[model samples]
Structures are given as C-alpha cells and as structure tokens.
Target: MKVEGIAAIVTGGASGLGLATAQALAGAGAKVALVDLNEQGAKAAAEPLGGIGIGCDVSDAASAEAAVARAAEAHGPARILINCAGVATPGRIVGKNGPLDLSVYSRVIAINLIGTFNMMRLVAAAAQSLDPLDGGERGVIVSTASVAAYEGQVGQAAYASSKAGIVGLTLPAAREFAPVGIRVCAIAPGIFETPMLLGLPQDVQDSLGRSVPFPSRLGKPEEYADLVMSIIRNPMLNGETIRLDGAIRMQPR
Candidate 1:
C-alpha cells in the first residue's frame, strides 16, 4: 500500500530497528506513531519525525489498547504496524545458579511473543473496519524475529522460544488476515549493531561480526527498514519470515 499520508504504528520505535522503520515510514509520508516504554525517548524520537510518541507496554493488554487509541486519536487508525519491541536476555535452563528463573523466561515471552500478538490483534481490529486500498489491501504488519529462533545456541532457551513463537504466528496471522486485506510477515535478523550489542566490548563485537559468512559485519538498522518498505510495497510478500542474516548460521558456543 502507498505509505503517503497513511497512519502507522511502530512499537519500540525509540531505538534500534523500530526507530529506523519509523524514520523510513515517516520519510515516505506516513503519519507515524512511536510507541515505546521510554516516554522521553519516544517523544524525542518522534519530534524530529513530526510524529507523535506514546509510552506503551506492548505486553500489557490495557497499555497496548490505550496506545492504539491514542494513535488513532492523533493519526487515525493505522494502516501499518511494526512490532519491534523485544528482549534478548539469554540464559540456560540450568545455569550456574541452577535452573533459570521462571520469571526470566516468562518476561521474554510476554514482551517478544505475547506483545507481538497483542499489538497485531489491536491494529488488525482497526484495519478490519477500514476501506480497502488498491488491490483490496487495507494494512500491512511487519514483525521482528531472530536467527536464534531457528538455530538457538546453548544459552538462548527463552529468547529462542519466544522468537520461534513469532515465526509460528506469522503464517496463521497472514491466513486469518488475508480476507480483510491485511498482510502479516516477519524478518528474522542476524546479529545487528543494535544498542544492546554495541554495549559489549569492541573486540567482542568485532568477533561477532566476523562470524557472519560474507560481508562479514553486523547488519545496519537501515537495512532492516529497507526490507520493511519493500514488503509494504510488494503485496505478495505475506505469511513468510525472511531472514536478513548475512548467510551466517550461528554455531553453538
């Protein structure tokens, strides 16, 4: 669908992949909303884009509802939804401290998996009521997954499970939304130069980058955003998870 003048919502839009996508969408004339847990950061990010920022906990039903309502109040019902809010707190089932805390696993699942569904359902409900655009398209949703979902390493039980759930949700969501002219797809990115990864020592970061098979470097946020734009433009790209990894299959460490 044409992004110009359409309303769009991007969770975790204060930083990383979500931020990049918000910028891209806004640049393309979409009325973007930056929804994030960081109120100040969200506002700061939105200001330059001429978009509104809302503080929202995507995992919570009420919080997500309020956020969607606020976005509708400001920009109307969204025709684009990007789910990028997630946590990658890695841990083993049985760590040095014995079995990992159940809360840790639950937390990851809530934010990464459930949060995705929460936002998707709310946005889809709004999209359903809207009139279809060209080719009977009403809206598009792009979610973030990870290479770990397919090949989880030793210490990524919770993270992998959560992402795998996202992968599992893609096809069913697409099939369900198809009739309403809403498309659902996901991007499974390899290691990227996100803030979390940048926080590590430079040497460690370099080592990780070198692990990629070719072009041998971490992905840029803009690259991910480009894919989002592509998907939005190409209506046929639905119900699929595209891996943005640089031909790298992570090995067990």
Candidate 2:
C-alpha cells in the first residue's frame, strides 16, 4: 500500500540496501523501525527520519522476537516487513587448502537464510492479526535475494546456497500467506553498489559494473528500494523473484 502512516520494519537498516529502503519508507511517511546488529549505528541512521532503531541478531529467535515485539509496542504491528539482513562471505566447497570450513558455510546459511525466516514468521504473524486493508491486503514482505542464487561464480558456494534458499522460499510463503491477505516476494539483485562491494578497489568495482549488458554500471541501493515499493504497491506481484540485474548472467570465475 500507500505506506503513509503504516508501520514498517527493515532489517539491516544501518547501511547499504537496508538503510536505503528504510530511508525510502520513512520519506513516504511510514512509521519506520530500523533493525540491525549495530544498535548505535541503526539509531544514528534512523534519527533524522524520526524513526526508532532496534538491536537484533536476525539469526537468533529470542533476539528477533524481542526486536519485533519492541517495534510493535512502539508503532503497532508492522504491515511492511523488508528482509535485508544478509552476509556474502565468499568461499569454495573444495579449496586449495582443503575442504571449506563447515563453520564458514554454516554461518552463511544461519544468518542469510534462517535469519530471514525468523524475522518473516514474526512479522507475518503480527500482520495476519491486523484487519485487512483495501483489496484484502494485510501486509507485504519483500526479501533480498541475490543473482548468485541463479548464477553463482566459482567462489560463492555458501553464499549462493543461502540466496537460493530464499528464492525457493518465496513461492511457498506467498501461497501459504494468501489466505491471510499477505503477499510475499523477493528481489534477486546483481552487482549492486552495496557497502561490501564498494569496499573493493575502484578499478575492481568499475570492472564489475561493466559486466552488465546495458546501463553498464552498478545497481544503486535506491533502485532496489524502488522495486520494493513497486512490489508493495502492485498486489498482483506475488510468489515471484524479480531480478534487478541488468541482464547479467554471471560466468564461472
């Protein structure tokens, strides 16, 4: 919906795409709650928007529950929940040293995949209890996947698997939530200009940008936010994973 005066919670809201989405929601007059592991950073980023920030570890059930509870207490149960908290730690299953550390892969799965589900369940439960809005829509959930889910390069075994899980989750979630007037969708972004990618050398960043077929530049975080707004507005777009990549099917490195 319109977002105006509605409650929203954006995970990973301290920086990058999460922060961008939170800024967009706040600008559109949503009562925004910014959640991140860095509580101070989240608080600082949310200050100018007149929003609240909460500290949370999305992978932990207790932490996520407490965060959602606090947000609901402060702004009523949220109708818009955006899942942007993720990690992209690159690793190979079989490396030169040896088999990849199980912990490495586990960490990625726990935070990127399980963490998303943890937040989604909590937010959706709250949303389902609220009275339906116009068109029988109670809420919208837009999660952040990655192009790597489809075309993972050589060094992204763990990261790719985690994102692929998100892709697989979207449809089933949508189908399950349909009766409750909730919509579920995901965005599979390519090489966006997120904080992690921007930390690379300038030439590396430029090279990565040029890999796109057209509009040969990195995708902006705001563009991701724009797509999220579109998904929230258009009720027909559910159970789908829209690729925000500019026709960039990655090659094996």
Candidate 3:
C-alpha cells in the first residue's frame, strides 16, 4: 500500500526504532499514530509529525482496543501497522539464584510476543474491511524480531523465545491474511543503536559495535526504518522475516 495519505500506527513510537519508523511514515505523508507506554513522550514525539499519540498496553485487550479506536477516530483505521513495542529484560532460565522468576519470563512473553499479536489482529481486522488498494492490497504489517531468536546468547532465554514467536508467526499470519489482501512480514535486527543500548558506556558500546563483521558499528534506527519502507512498497514481499543485522551471527556469551 502507498504510504502517502494512508493511516499508520507504530507501537513503541516514543523512541528507538518505532520512533524512527513513525518519522519515516510521517515524512512520506502518512497519517501516523504513535502508541507507547510513555504517554507524555509519545504525545511529544507525535506532535511535530502532525500525528496523534496514544498510551496503550499492547498486551492488554481493552487498552489496545481503546487505543486503536482512538487512532481510527483521529486518522481512520491504520492500514500500516508496525510492531516495535517490546521489553528486553535479560535473564537466564536457570540463574545463580536458582531458576529465574516466573514473573520475569511471563512478562517478557506477554509484552513482546502477545503484544505484537494483539496489535496485528486489531489492525488487520480494520484493514480487511477497507476496499483493496492498488494491486489489491488492503494493508501491511511489519513486526520487529531479533537475531537472538536464532542465536540467543546466555541470559536471553525469555527475550529469545519471545522473538522466536515472532519469527514463527510470520508465515502463518501471512497465509491467514492472504485472502484479505493484507501482507505480514518481520525484521530480525541484530545489535542496534537503540536508546537502551545507548545508555551503556561509550567504550562498551564501541566494543559491541566492533563485534559486527562489516560496518563494525551498531545499526541505526533510521536504517531499520528504511527496510520497513521498502517492505511496505514491495507487494511481492510477504510471509518472511528479513534480518537487518550487519551479517553478524551472535555467539553464546
């Protein structure tokens, strides 16, 4: 679907990759909605872009529904749904303090895996009702996976599993939405210069950057946005999880 004049929603839009995508969509003339747990920050982020910002817990049915409803009221139902809301609370399944707490594992799954699905189902439902666009396409959904899903290092069991769920979800979701002319795809990014990572010491960040075989630096949020824009523009791309890593396969740490 064309980004210009289309409605788009990006979760985790307060900062990081989500924000970058929202920026790109807005720049492309899409009516954008920024959704995040940080309500104030989301509002601020969306204001300059002429988009609306909403506070929502992507894991909760009621909250997500309300958020989607609000976005529809403001900019019509979103045809482009980008799933970037997630938590990366690293923890081992078995740790020095015995098994990791059940809460830790459950929280990660709830927010990262279930959250992506929650937004997808709602957005796809809305998009399906709209008349097909050029090329019979109704909508597009691009979610964020992680290279950790394939090569999860130590202390990432929960994070890895949640991302793996995203990878597993791609093909099935694309097949299910095929009849409706809605495309589903995902991007599995490696180490990137997200706000979470930026908080680390400069030397530590540099060391992490050096680990990548080429470019030898952290991926930029804007680079990820470029990939999303490409996927949205290409109708032939569907049911696949494309890696945005700098050709780096992580080692078990």
Flag clash pairs in model 1. Answer: none
- For residues 1-253, what per-residue lDDT tens digits would candidate 1 score against the true structure? 8999999999999999999999999999999999999989999999999999999999999999999999999999999999999999989999898999999999999999999999999999999999999999999999999999999999999999999999999999999999999999999999998989999999999999999997799899999999999999999999999999999998887
Q: Compared with the true structure, what per-residue lDDT tens digits does model 3 show for residues 1-253?
A: 6799999999999999999999999999999999999999999999999999999999999999999999999999899999999999998889899999999999999999999999999999999999999899999999999999999999999999999999999999999999999999999999999999999999999999999998899999999999999999999999999999999999999
Question: What is the C-alpha local distance difference test score of each model?
Answer: 0.96, 0.95, 0.97
Candidate 2: Cα lDDT at 3: 91
Write down the TM-score of every candidate. Answer: 0.99, 0.99, 0.99
Please give the clash total of every predicted structure, in order: 0, 0, 0
lDDT of 2 by residue, 1-253 (tens): 7799999999999999999999999999999999999999999999999999999999999999999999999999999999999999987789899999999999999999999999999999999999999999999999999999999989899999999999999999999999999999999999999999999999999999999998899999999999999999899999999999999999998
lDDT of 1 at 238: 100
Off by over 4 Å in 1: none
Model 1 local distance difference test score = 0.96
Tell me the spans in candidate 3 whose CA falls farther than 4 Å from its real position.
none
